[model samples]
Target: MTEAAARRAPTRAPEQDPGARGGVRRSSVRGQVLDALRAALVDGDLAPGEVYSAPALGERFGVSATPVREAMQQLALEGAVEVVPNRGFRVARRGARELGELAEVRALIEVPVMLRLARSVPAGRWEALRPLAEATVAAAAAGDRARYADADRAFHRALLGLSGNGQLVQVADDLHRRSQWPLVTGPVHARRADLVADAAEHTALLDALVVGDLGVVQSLVREHFAGS
Candidate 1:
């Protein structure tokens, strides 16, 4: 095992919910642990391809191994991690090809929906989402990866929500998270300049949306995933 793998240990306790009932409280804590572990994976704190036992992860989060196992199972379903027989779990390693495929999938679902929204929704509607878009840029400028991820998800979700299709938003959100997953090699948003440039793309996308420019919007959508 690598030094990184060796250090995976329960370092803290999971926070408990005081208001909920027995099962609800357990479920709530499990969800919280799941979210924390997911964030740690995205933040590159839990090294990809490094196997970590559920007990160790549970220890780190100050939670029971059961919740950690449940969280890891969810991560496995998301393709963020995989199970190891008689061992534990390791963050799945994805390459450029997988990312490209996800980009293609996202473009197929999002582009047409976005184009339709440009025609149907008023300029003011898109303009109203300007703050959400700007928030992403601000997050990127500050080199806040977690903030950027949240803002990015919010901005895209809001934009896609303009289509008034809940299912579409859910699917797009799943693909978006996969696209943002940290590579086994490292986190993509480590460099400030790259994030700044990507942030500018958000501003440009908003411009196209506000003007209801289908051509520009389509082009920007394709270009947006080019580097991602």
Candidate 2:
């Protein structure tokens, strides 16, 4: 290799590809480890306040300790997990104020970006959004708290897809994934009516998108996140 090539950082040195969806490319052992660990973290497979055993997790993912250690290090950097001294990685704890701030920052970054990506928001995008929003509404109506939360998460993910910036979508996902901590802190059992109302508000946001109403859409986003 030339001097310049030698000086370059070996990003893929050990066969890890953290590439985005489409080229999704979750092919290598390291990539599999990272993706599995990330899924477990984000999907509440490892619940809030649940301590993760590095070796146990490695066993479940069918890998050895080394890659699990590396993945845990990366997750810690991403704020998905916390590194406790001599205790390995633990799920990060968060409170209501922190969750609300996360949603606020996501709105601040994403609303404008979504407005810009409005042209690509496709005429049929609302068709895709409707079912997810309805699923949230139905879950809320049925008083299924966990299912409601999952549906709520799906609604946000669909909204993130509106931005069309693969990287930016992950920023919003990171913020929301951290939200589950506080999401269950309150009386979600008593909040079904409120959640249903939130789903209806999403309908309005969908309508705003349809009409290309940037101001109203941004306002709706702020209001929706403010209650978090």
Candidate 3:
């Protein structure tokens, strides 16, 4: 197995062995494969528009093709990949325009909510999200795109969750995930310094919100989405 695949492999407890619980073991393997595939997509390990067979991925992960196929089907549903008849799955080809649209939609939904939160939510509430913001910075500094993506989403989710609207959070999260997909024609991985700068924006936004600076909050939010 590849080192990346090895790192992503799930460790089973003795009682959860395949022999003792075949179905549970399969499900666990499938879930791990799904997560690994998503990480691969975010990290640009899976090239856009390229078809990849389950057996090929299975060999790389040192697992049977069944779990890989199941995970690819889930990715299909997520629009991360598409079925290719009898061949395999092709990584979805996302372009700059699609990414820009996703960012626009996110800003439409989140900007107003954040502005409102800045006015109503206490400074302590904004302060509480500092750890999550810092996590993104750490991940960016480590040059780990997958980890940075996860941290970025967590920070946004937590910030949006403050609205107390489950549906809004779900919608915003979907948009956020799509925005993270790499563009097919440009540099897949961002420069480490760019990642660090982007991560710093979270902290800057929080600082603006804490001080009840609506103008600064609005400007930061719009500029952030524009950069996305």
Candidate 4:
């Protein structure tokens, strides 16, 4: 665990608005835009503390300011970005205390949730996660920023059933986007040997969860943050 990552607090939960939120059924234009942007943030294409404008984004998405503003509001509520008074929004700043608090809250939410998910954290699911996990490792090795970031998050998402709490997973998504985790595992450090260690830890968690080893799983989970 790096001293830097270990010190981040939980004040700024970053955005996880990626992929499609409302599905492709065309529920609302704003919702879809929000989903795409959130996914971008989670994927690290949109780094923490990056500033962007709603109008420009709306134009880029072939929409208007209304949906863009609405989507930004939803993201703000999720703690991904902050809406400046006159300025649009900027990715929340990262700090030790902020990340620590985020980690603490996530632990509170996920530990019990995962405890409950113990029954459902099956081998079949582990098998499914294998490919994602392997991809993450490969990304780390190859220094593929985009692939690593997306694959890393996907591996976590692949376990949505393990936590058995959709809300818990959402909470994690919200926190990680803003967390210094990007700095730790982000592409800037994609080729770092330490990141490979982090990938191994993720695999360890999967193994522990698969075997229903709560003690080890929870311990590793906490250490993941502590070591970060």
Give the alpha carbon lDDT tens digit for every residue of 1-228 in model 2. 222222221233333355654433333555657756655543346666767777877666655666777788888887778887776788887776677778778778776776666656765776668888788778778755456666777887788777667787777777765564433434645576777788787778888877777788778877887766
Per-model CA lDDT versus the true structure: 0.79, 0.67, 0.83, 0.64
On the 0 to 100 scale, the lDDT of residue 212 in model 3 is: 87
User: Superposing all C-alpha atoms, what RMSD in Å does each candidate have to the true structure?
Assistant: 4.2, 10.9, 2.8, 9.1
Superposed model 1: Cα runs more than 4 Å off: 1-22, 184-190
Ranking by TM-score: 3, 1, 4, 2
Q: Summarize candidate 4's per-residue lDDT along 5-83 as a digit string, tens digits.
A: 1222112211233575744323355566765666556445456787878887665556666667878888788777889
User: In model 2, what lDDT does residue 149 have?
Assistant: 60
Model 1 lDDT per residue over 1-228, tens place: 223323333344434566655667677767877777766775577776789998887777777889899889998998888999878998878778888899899888988887788788898988998898889889788776656777888999999998888999999999998887873343544566677888888889899988888888888888887777
Model 3 clashing residue pairs (backbone): none
Models sorted by lDDT, best on top: 3, 1, 2, 4
Q: For each candidate, what TM-score against the reference?
A: 0.86, 0.60, 0.90, 0.63
Question: In candidate 3, what are the lDDT values of residues 11-107, reduced to their tens digit?
Answer: 5323136575457777778888888888888767788889999998877666778888999998898788999999999998887788888888999
Largest TM-score belongs to which candidate? 3
**Worst window of 10 by summed lDDT in candidate 1:** 1-10
Model 3, which residues run further than 4 Å from truth?
Answer: 1-6, 9-22, 183-190
